[model samples]
Target: MQDAGFVWNAEELDAFIESPRKHVRGTNMSYPGERRPEKRAAIIEYLTQLSTAD
Candidate 1:
């Protein structure tokens, strides 16, 4: 899945990590309206750092 340019939202990401088939519906070629993992991960990591900093 990572080989192709597939993006995932928060809910989508959660669902995907848990079960790719269940969450991923419709088109297999593309993930309808989703954010990139790198972007999402960066945001999450940043938030974690901020929380820890506080």
Candidate 2:
């Protein structure tokens, strides 16, 4: 989900990152483990890096 240096609106980015589980219900994805926090943090960090990269 990292934008890889692409620009996106702050609201859109926040929605994607803080979206509720129900919003993702139809997707074929699952985070069923204790590593969920770590994984999510990694994604956020990656996206942040991409957003901040010049």
Candidate 3:
């Protein structure tokens, strides 16, 4: 999370997954975010698991 410069929560992760560029203007990351809700939810779930497993 050091790279993000902030603590990520559920809503923040959802928004970020929807659009990285829109979330953080002028970010170098060019990766277009997930268009499918299921996929995005999965990714967020996985990330959450990582955070909690620590």
TM-score of model 3 relative to the true fold? 0.77
lDDT of 3 by residue, 4-42 (tens): 666678877887888988876777777899888898899
User: Which parts of model 1 are misplaced by more than 4 Å?
Assistant: 1-34
User: Highest TM-score: which candidate?
Assistant: 3
lDDT of each: 0.53, 0.50, 0.81
- On the 0 to 100 scale, the lDDT of residue 43 in model 1 is 57
Per residue, candidate 1 scores C-alpha lDDT tens digits across 1-54 of 554346644555544644455455543644343346666566556765777794
Model 1 lDDT, full chain set: 0.53
The residue pairs found clashing in candidate 3 are none
lDDT of 2 by residue, 1-54 (tens): 342334555434443455533334444436432235555566677888998999
Q: Worst 10-residue stretch by lDDT in candidate 1?
A: 26-35
Which candidate do you rate higher for TM-score, 1 or 3?
3
Taking all chains together, the TM-score of candidate 1 against the true structure is 0.37
Winner on TM-score (2 vs 3): 3
- Which one wins on lDDT? 3
Worst 10 residues of 2 by lDDT: 20-29
Q: Give the TM-scores of the predictions, in the order they appear.
A: 0.37, 0.41, 0.77
Model 2 clash count equals: 0
